[model samples]
Structures are given as C-alpha cells and as structure tokens.
Target chain A: MDILLEMLEKDARLTPEQIAIMTQKDEGDIKAAIDSYESRGVILGYKALVNWDKTEREYISAIIELKVTPQRDRGFEKIAEKIYNYPEVKSLYLMSGAYDFQVILEGKTLREVAQFVASKLAPIDGVISTATHFVLKKYKDNGCVFKVPEKDERINSI
Target chain B: MTDYSKKLSKTAQSISPSGIRKFFDILDDMDDVTSLTVGQPDFATPWHIREAAIDALSAGKTYYTSNAGLTPLREEISKYVKRRFSLDYGKDEIITTVGGSEAIDLAMRALIDPGDEVIIPVPSFVCYGPIARLAGGVPVYVDLDEKDGFTLTPEKLERAITPKTKLLVLPFPNNPTGSVMRLPELEKIADIIEKKDIFVLSDEIYAELTYKGRHVSIASLDGMRERTIIASGFSKAYAMTGWRLGYTLAPREISVQMLKIHQYAIMCAPTASQYAGIEALCAGDEDIEYMKAEYDRRRLYIVNCLRSAGFECYEPLGAFYVFPNISKYGLDSESFCSRLLYENKVAIVPGTAFGSCGEGFARISYAYSVKHISSAVEKLADFANKIKNERKL
Candidate 1:
C-alpha cells in the first residue's frame, strides 16, 4: 500500500502538507495522490471512528448470520446485492462457512434491528433462515481501541 | 545531627542527580500536562513476544539459566544480529545482562582500570559519564558539533584521546540528540580508534530506530571488530523496557571478564525475558518495522512542527527524540524547559539533562501519539509567541 494512504487510514485529519513532510514527499504530489486515490475509488470515504456507545445517542447493532439459496443464474452475488440495498444493513459479506451471508445491521434499538431481520430480511424469496446476534459492547472498532486512553504510567527519566 | 553526605562513597556523592529531576518534581504537582519526556517506546510489547513469555511462565521455566544466559537465546541473538544488522557473533561471545545498563556497567567494570581515561562524546546518553566515574575511569568528553549531526568526527575524537585513553564510548543512535552515525562517518572515527588502539564500547541501544541509510556499527568496520563491544537490548526495538533484558557482544577475552561480572552481579538475564527475547529475535522483525515507521512519521512531524514554531530543530534520523536548539530565547536549556513545563503545562527535558554541551538545547521525545505531541507542540508554539511578544515590548 502507498505510505500516504496508510497514513490517512490511521488519521484522516492529517493535511497533505503534514503528510508530505512526514513521508518526505512533495506536498503537491501528496495532494495529487490523494485526489487520484479518491477518484479511483481506492478511498471509499473519510469517516471518523467515533465511540457512539459513550455518547448520548441511542444506537444498537447486530450481526445477522443468514442462510439463503442462490438464484439460478447468479450465485450469492444477487442475494448480497438485494440485502445490501436495505438502509439498516451497514455491512454485508458473503461467508464461506455454515452461513451464506453475514449481514451487519444497525438501528436505534434492539427491536428495530430484529424487525429488519424478520420483516425486511426473512421475507425475501431467496432467504432461507436468519439468526440474529445483537452486539452487546464493542472493545474495538475498525483499528481504534474503544476505551479511554490509558495514562502513561511510566515515570520520566533521563 | 549526622552529616550523611560524608558517609556515602565520594565517587557516588560527587555525581549530580539528573538535571531533569526538577522537571519530574514540577510535573508531579501539575495536571493535564502534555509531556514529551519519555525515553522509551510508547508502544506496548508485541503480543506474540508477550505470549511467548506467558508460555514460558506457564511451562514453569522459572529457574535461573546460566550466567551467559539460555544457549538457545544466545544462538538466536547471534542469528538476529547477523540477519538484521550484518553483525557476526559466536554464541560464547554474547552474555545476557539485566538490561543494557548492566551491559554498559559490565563493560566499564571489566575494562576500566583506576586511572584509565574513557573518551565519551557529549550531548549523548546520560549514563556513560557517571558509570565511567563509578568504575574509577576518567571521563573525557568531546562535544559533538550540531553541524555534524551531533556525531563525533575523527578530528574531535583524536583531540580528546590521551595516551592513557583505554576506551572510546561510541553511542550512535544517541539518546537526547537522536544522532545516527552512518557508515562513512563511523568509518572515519573507526580509523582513529584503530590507530589509537583503544577498546570501543559501542552502545547501540537505539540501533533499530535509525531512519537514515542504516546504522553502521564500528565493529563492522575494517579492524575495529576486536575492539568494539556492542551493548544493546530489546527495550527500544521491541518495546520491552520493563522486561530488563539486554546483552553485550564482545571478543572472547572481554566476554570472559563480562561473564565474570554477570556471574557475580546479575547471575543471568530474567528467564522469561530471555524466552521473550528469543521470540523477539525470531519473529519480531515485522514488529520492529511497524514501530519504527510510526516513530519515523512522528520524528518528521515533531521536527517540522518545532521548526515552524520558531525554533531551530535538526531533522533527527534516529531514535525517538528531537533535540531542538532552544538557545534563541536568551534562556538556557533548563530555564527554557522549566518555563515550558510550568507555564505551558508541557514537559520536555532540558538538553543539559544529557550533558553540559546540551545546555542550549531541549529534547522532546516523539515516543507518543501524534495527538499527544501535537497538543504539547501547540502549547509550546503559543509559549514561544508569547515570549516573542514580551521581548518586543
């Protein structure tokens, strides 16, 4: 991977100028590279990894292990496309194990997610069975550790 | 009342406490101080290495190993230096000590006679002088030129060495200064040492942190192998400072003496840490690269930030600290750093903490998160602006 992309992946707040100095590249080149990455769809979007659990916002997320039959002309791609189009389906992946599709859904409450899985998801023609496991807490998200930063316990010495 | 000062060893008594001790006290009383004063890696020990130690503990390898340390670990260290550093060492030539500090001390004790002079470059690590004095050796300090990237040039080294010079302490990837000695630079210095025929105690503790071409050990040079003793450990490389594991690589004669000191003083390095050291040598190359890249980014960031904030900072190519010149404020290093700590609520070490040659400088460690360093740099920039405004008034 490009060093600039790696830097931005870890921290999107960093400016092109700062990254130029860090990677010892021209600032103009960094800007151009970032532009190319964005236009080429290599960079999907810049989003903050917020710990919403700590905020006053009400949120619930669940991973629904799905078992489904593929359409005759298409494999799991058709079903995955159908399931990903739903607003609550935050993440969708075709699995290689006991389950066919692994759908991650997020909503305001536990019932909202279960309602999506039951009414919107299970009602699909190709959908065979659905097993929903609500996420209780997040210890990590993306690459960021979901916890208060640990105080540096080391005593300063020369 | 008793006069306790007179009862202590005069050698120990004469050595002053670290100049940064005042900052420690001041910082202790403060709150929300964004400090860049750490001298070790901020990263945790890699989980695989830690897991190896845990495995050893579970397997009940609690007993002490040999004075020279576990043979497998010693062999692993041999392979590690060979592949990572191109350093060749036989198994018997390495003796694991309790951290690099003890390796340094062992080298000092094993080699120094009462009146021998040990040449050390200044504005480097703080331990060499005191340890040399304790070993009854006279510390001959040669101030490194900032223009030379705080590296000891051949001329300066030649000028400092007397007929009584027994050892020249080469501390590349130096602490506080963050100076790295590249091969050409080291080769020049190595030429002088070979001619002068003095033993070299090369402290490459920050060897893995070199950001330039590569760290060149004087031992790797032409005829200096027999004279050079490298004292290093996993503390900086693997972020295993708490493990207290370090070793010394030297010739058989010196290793024999160092082993004697190890037997008498340390017995061996910690058993579990030795196990972890083996794992680090075997599988921690990726971990080193990962942490070193993070540090390289932080190094460039801190140097650029300090330069923009109206200070003269050399782009450090090694280690985790940036020794920015703070002499422009018409204040000494200690005074400048004290004001930063008290007023800005940011703690960085005065350069004099490392050596008197560091009197006009300050060391800000980049062994921290970018956010943490940015906040401190912001406060520092504000403080510098205020100082500028007041001077104008």
Candidate 2:
C-alpha cells in the first residue's frame, strides 16, 4: 500500500499499466490501490493555478496576526472558531507565543480589510488586538516557485 | 447552512473577490462621485464599426458563427497581426472569443494542468491568476520594478520561473502602470522561453492603443510562434467592449484544445458582433486612428495636470490610464481614492487594488472626453492641495 501510494503521488498522470510496470505489480493491483485511495478519501481533488496578475479580476491578500485571550474551558479553540467562521478568512492557524493565532484574510481592498478588522474580528468577545500584514510578494507557494533559469543556466544546464 | 452549499468546489469558493467591483459598488450607490475608476475605455464603439453591426443586422446576419469565429474576421485578424507586429497566424489557429476576457480564459483552460506554475508580473491586469487557478494551474507573481517604468526585466522574468513553470502571462501595454515592451525587451524574454518549453500567454489587448513605438509581440521573435498565445480584441482599438468580441491566435494544436473548451462553455461569440468585427478589421482603420488620437490628447492633458498639481505622474506610454504616484499625500491608495471620491467627487481606482506593488499610487483613466478629463483633473488638483495643506506636506 505504501509503495502504491508513493507511485501515485510521484506522478498522478501515470497510467495503471505504467504504474504496474514501474511498481513490478499487476495492473489490477494498481487499479485497486487507486480505487481504495479514492474511497478512503486520500486523493481528494485536483485544482488549477491562475495568474491573477494578468487577468481582469482584482486580488488582495493579507495575513492578520491575531492576539487573543483564551476562554477558560473553551480555550483558544473558541476564539479560533469565530475567526475562521468568516468566509473571507482563507487560512487560520493557532500559534505559540507572541501572537495567539494568525488568520489570513483575502478581500478586494485595504478598506475592506480595515472594515473586517473593525467590524468583525475586533468586535468579537475575548479577541484581543490584531495586526494585519498585506502580502507584498509571493515568491513561492503550493510547491511552485516563479523563477526562470539564468542565461548561462539555460544554455549549459538542462 | 444549505445542503447545496457543500457542492461548491474549493476552487469556486477560492475565487479572489474582485477589488474593482467592490469599489464600483460603493461608487454606484454614491450620487456625487465622478468616477475614473473603471479600467475600460470610456469611448463608445466607433461609428463605422457600429454601422457594420447595424448593416449585419439589416442583412439578417444574426446567426451563430463557427465556433472559431467567421473566416473573414479570423483572416483579417491574421493580416492585422502581420501588418501590425509581423506575427503570422493562420485563420485555423485563431479562435474568436466572447471578449479578451474569454480569450484569456480559453488559453488558460487549454494549457494549464493541475499544479502547473504560471508566472504573472504585477501590478497588472487582475484576471490572470484567478482564471489560471480555475484551469487547475497555480499563479506565481513576479513584481515588476517601478523604477524601470513597471517593465518586466529579463532578470525579473528569469528569477520568476521554476521547473514547474508552464505558462508566463505577458501583460504589456499594461494596466495601471501603462508600461510597454519594445522589440529588444521582448527578445530577452524570447531567449529564455525558447529553452524552457513553457507556454506564453501574450495579452496584447491594448496593442493598438500604445503611445510609444509600435507594440511588438514576443511571438514574432525566433522560435516563439509555436510557444505563445496572442490574446487581443477590438475593445480598446475599435471601442467595441460592448460588442464582446476578442480572439486568440496560437499554434493549431493549442487552438484546437482551446476551441474544444470554448465550444463546450460558450457555444459561439455573439454572431452580429463577429460580423461587426469583420467590418472592424476590414474598414475600422479611420475609427482606430481617430480614437487613438483622442486618447492621446486626454493622456497628455491628464499627465500634465497631475504633474503640475504636485503629483508624481508616470507618463504612461500605453493603455488609457495614468498611474500617478500619490505617496506624498501620506494616504494609502484605498484611502486616497475613497477620500477623493467623497471630497472632490472624482473617483479613481487605488493602485493597491492591482497588486501590492501598486501601493502609493492611483490609476486614473484618461479614456473619458477632454472636457471630463479637464474637470476631473481640476477637482483632483484641488483635492491634492487640500490634502497637502492639511497634512502640511
């Protein structure tokens, strides 16, 4: 099962016959492995990457460092529940020290972020202070980096 | 919560909320706003082009066109490419789309596989990344330098590519910044792309509206024809935004794939619009020249006005926008834009809405008439004076 999972992860595009050949297993075994993985919810889904910089729609992203006081019995989970509930919060993380949590919110403009800070998160009970940092540059994310080869690298190295 | 809400894919839910639309919504409800916030050309469709659409309707040519678009229109587009930028593409390689928007959509859908990396330069058109994601590709952004007139240097391009890089969206004749790439600039890009086996989505929608030397296509360079998809439309040139006609020229295999997706999603671009497009290609030269001249006039007027008013205005060499640096006002782009709209009744899009690099600037469109341009500039100048006085700058 581990070998099967490894092969599938390496190349999702590999055909069953190809996977079987690579794994030294029967095609039936490869097919069953894929089916079981799907049934067990291991291979969730596929997605596309969009170059928003070139498109017509606008994109704004910000990481909001949230300072919160944990409730007695509910602890930080209760505060996290409120922060993550908003649809604008793309990602939320419970952290250690300094900041209690970090929430990534995406909106159309700075005003929208300001509004969210004032109206939504700040007003929530037990929520302390929040500092928002807009992402200035995204050098790498989701296993993709935007870097072309140097002229020498392009010429000499593959 | 509704059960139907669960059916939405993560991608669908992840669509970046539109910054422009959000502001526009606010401006819409406000009665006193004089808006320059829109990215579209304020010019109406040229009379000759409109006549062509009217003629098409009169002649009862209001049926669906071939999925790829009318042959004559495609042929004219092919000729337009050659005559304008020395790029050669046959009618077979062209797909007429709903708009340049759709052309971009089709290109991404056709080329991007899941997890493929697409390089996008900022601050630029906002649609590229979202559309790429919808097509199962990841968008990686490279910030273009303001010091370099927002032009994407070969150094920047090289630093932005990776092993997973599958597509690079070249949005020159850029929005917000109004930068353009010349032949020498394109050659550097061509050199890098030749070895990478990556596809290029060259969005030259504002190709005809350039104020600098003629627009050049990277695809025209050696070995680039096969690797680049040229997406353009008559929207800016013929003032045909409402017509909803744009096209993409690519290698035949890619065109075929794009057409397959386009056919499934959009049966055909508007039929009358295609005929009008043919007319636009065949006889819209005078209209193009007239509108270009008008835009040039407003461009000069606005730039001069902004500069004389103590704003650091970047002279946009292409597109119909003047992105002026408003940092001295000590207000962020969003605050500056909103306050301008509220106080002076003049609306401009915040540069921050374009990208992070767009902070400290505001995009003011000169696509309006000279009269509106003068009035808006006067109001803007007064607003700037007020801010400077209050802030003691």
Candidate 3:
C-alpha cells in the first residue's frame, strides 16, 4: 500500500512528520516522495471535502446529462471540452449507461443552474440536447458521508 | 463485613491491575481531551465484512458453533495462515477463540504448570505476565533493548532460560513497542529454542499490519514449527475487534488441549463472527491493504511528531504505537503522562503501563484521525518543551 497517498487522501492536513510515523519512513523521505508524486502529477492537489450546506452559503448543484452528436474524429471529446470549459462546471465525465456525458455544476440558485444549461451548454456545437437534474440534497459526496449519524454521547471508556 | 480479599484467588489478588485504567478515570471527567492512548484501530470494519455478519445474523446463525468453532471459519483460518505466513496448520489443528486475548489465556492455562516459569519479554504487551501468573506460572521478564529496536537478542533469551522455563512467549509485531522480528532475527531465536526443550507461544496479532516487509512467523522457521503455537486473529487486521473473533493454530497435541479448554469455557466463538471471520479471511485482503496504508501514514506522522517533541523515538515497524524515550525530560513515564493529560488535555499511555522496563518511555498510539494525532502531537511537544524549559531554570 502507498502510505503517503493514503494519508493525504484521508486528510491532506497531515504533515510530513506525521506521515513519517505512519509509514515507518523518515520525514525527509516522505517529503521527497510527496514532492516526486506532485511533480509527476500523481498528487494534483488537495482540497477539503467541504459541507457548504452547514453554513448559510446559498448554492445549487445539478447533474446535467448531455447527449452529444460525435464530431468526426473527435467523438464526445470535442463537445465535452466545450461544456466543461464553463466556470460553473464542477466536474465532467463521459459516463456509460443512460448518459454519454454527465456534467456536474454549481450555481447560486436553481434558476442560475437552469440558465447555464439553457444558455451556455445547450447551444454548444454538436451538443444534441441537455437534461438538468437539480440535486435536492447530498447524503454522501466523493466517498465522504455528509450526514453524520447520531453518535452515542456517553464517554468512550478506555 | 465480608472479606473481599479472601473471596478472590491468590493469583488474582497478586496480579496488578492495568496501569492504563487509572488514567481513564481522569480522562472520563475531562472534556475536549485528545487521546493517543487507544490500542484499537480508528477505522470501521469494512462494509462487506459487516454486511456478511449482518447476513449471518439475519439468517438465524445465533446458535453456538462446534467446540472447535465453525468448520468453514477454521478452514479459512487454516488457509489464511498458510497463504499469508506460509505456516501449515490443518483446519483440525485450528481453534477459533473469542479474541486474541482468549487464545493467549488458553495457551497459558493449557501449558503452564504451577511454578513453571514463562519467559516473557518485558515492555511489550501487559497481558502476558498477568495471564501467565493467573495460570500459576512465574513470569520471567526479559527486557528488550531499545537500541535493537526492541528485538529480542539470542543472548538475552539464553540468559532468561532456566530449568523451570516451560514456555517462551514471543510477541512480535509487538504491542506498545511495536517491535517486529525479521526472518534472520527469528532464525537466531529459533536456533536457541531448537536446542531448548521449552515450547513457544507466538502472539502474532499484528502480523498483517507489519510495514517492514511481510511478517515472518517463528513457526515458519526451520525446526521451530513443531514447538510453536501461533495466536492471531481478525481484530487488528480486519478492524473486527468488537466482534470478539480470533483463533489459535498449533500442532495437534497442543491445539487439541487448547480446543478442550476453549470448548469447556467459550463453547465456541460467536457464530455470526465465525461467519464474519470466514469472510474476513476470504475477501478481506483489500480491506487490510486499505487500513494498513492508512496506519502506515499515521505511524510515520506519530514517530516524527514524538521525535520533534524532543524525545528519542524508535520508529515502530508493525503495530500502531510509537514508543518514545522521555528520560531526557527528567520526569518518569507516569508523571509525564499525567501532566500531559491534566495540562495539555492530550492523553497517552505511560510505558510503565506495559511493564517496569517501559518506565523511561511512553506509548503513543496513532490509531486516530490525522487531525486528532496532529493536535495531540502539538500538545505533547508543548508539554515536553514546558518541562524542558522548567528544568533549564
């Protein structure tokens, strides 16, 4: 198992020294390894799995399914790029199953997300049609559980 | 008034209570305490393993299993031991127990005669000495050298042996110290034991968690297989400690005796857990890898933090603990731990909690979230610096 990557994946806040103890490796070695991973694009970036809903921050998220007409020699790549180029797009994936492309985006409100789909996404060349499904709530996100279950409040006895 | 002292057996009265328990009393009252004191993993049992147990329970597998535990579970254990460590034990030679604790107890009770000395390496697991004493055996403490990464030397092992020494308890991927015996180290010990008539009780509970290459079981060494009884289980590896599922593997003669004790006492390990154990052994390899990778990260972080705290920390290879020498601060293990707990609100186990040899050290566990460990390490460093500066005046 790659210990350094695992630690960063769970909580990127871990220092090199902390990672050294976890992997039984030296701090310098861990730092160097992390640097190497970073340079090689293995570790692209680190970001918090934020629960923005907890705060009063108003935002709406949606998963827009797009059925695109493949451009000659480009396939979905050409249209995927066009749709994903928008600043509102959070994630873009060429998915199997019912949708050829699943574009996840965030906007200030439902109206904003819908406006982006109608104005920005639908009008793109080779883009056949778009179906916007507003996400009402997220129970989980990116393998992290958003809603923490009620825990036993009693003291955790040793 | 009833004489409570008389009600308990002599051995029970003689055995000292765990040193870690008193700290718990202090901890319970304190709010916002960051503890690196627990020995168990912070990770939940993986979804599939839990699902398997749930399936078993829902299917009405609540009855007691056979005396040797569920046959399928035993077979899985047998296969796992052979596959992972290359130690051969037939399904008939394995007995599923409540946990590694039960297997250790069973081994001691089945082997120890009154006055028979059990050579236990000190500054390791706390249970070995007390359990051996309860079985009416004298515990011969062999203090391991921190300079050797707490690996038991042949000379020390030879010196501890006496005519009365009946069993040698080899705790590798050890607790508290987190020392692991490499193949050559095990080979050297095997050479000594091969000549001696004493049997071996090899507790390898943390075998799978070893990051310094795969764990080399003493039983796998030449001429050591016949005399060794390996006690390990799913608790540490599979995060199944709450299930209370573990097993013991020995030669037929020893396993048969251990099974008899287990049958009479535990009847069987929880049937649902045995079902879960099979799943753990069969399909839980990926989960082990996942948790191990996570622990490896924490292990590095804790050791580095301890070293930065101005303590001499020997990097632990196998288990989740980092034992750091705190003698430089001029305070004993207990006092340092107590002060750290009371002042900094960060709790760690004093090394003396493991054994007297652990006096100059403290065992800090990394089986917590990285955030928790990071904060605790900062507090520990602050506490150490405070004490160091105070002494400078």
lDDT of 1 by residue, A1-158 (tens): 38888889889999888899888889999899989999999998999888999999999999999899998988788888889999889999888989998999999998888888888999988999999999999998898889998889887876
Worst 10 residues of 3 chain B by lDDT: B300-309
What's the best-to-worst order under TM-score? Answer: 1, 3, 2
Error of 3 at A31 (Å): 8.0
Error of 2 at B231 (Å): 0.5
Q: lDDT of all predictions, in order shown? A: 0.90, 0.83, 0.86
Per-residue lDDT for B296-393 in model 1, tens only? 98888888889888889988889898998888887888888888888888898988887788888988899998888888899999988887787772
Model 2 reaches an interface RMSD of: 27.6
Once fitted onto the true fold, the runs of candidate 1 whose alpha carbons sit more than 4 angstroms away are B1-3
State, as a TM-score between 0 and 1, how close model 3 is to the true structure.
0.91
lDDT score for residue B351 of model 2: 86
Listed for every candidate in order, the interface RMSD values in angstroms are 1.1, 27.6, 4.2
How good is model 1 by TM-score?
0.96
Query: What digit string (tens of lDDT, one per residue) describes model 3 on residues B148-230?
Result: 88999999999999989999999999888988999988888999898888889999999999985999999998888889888
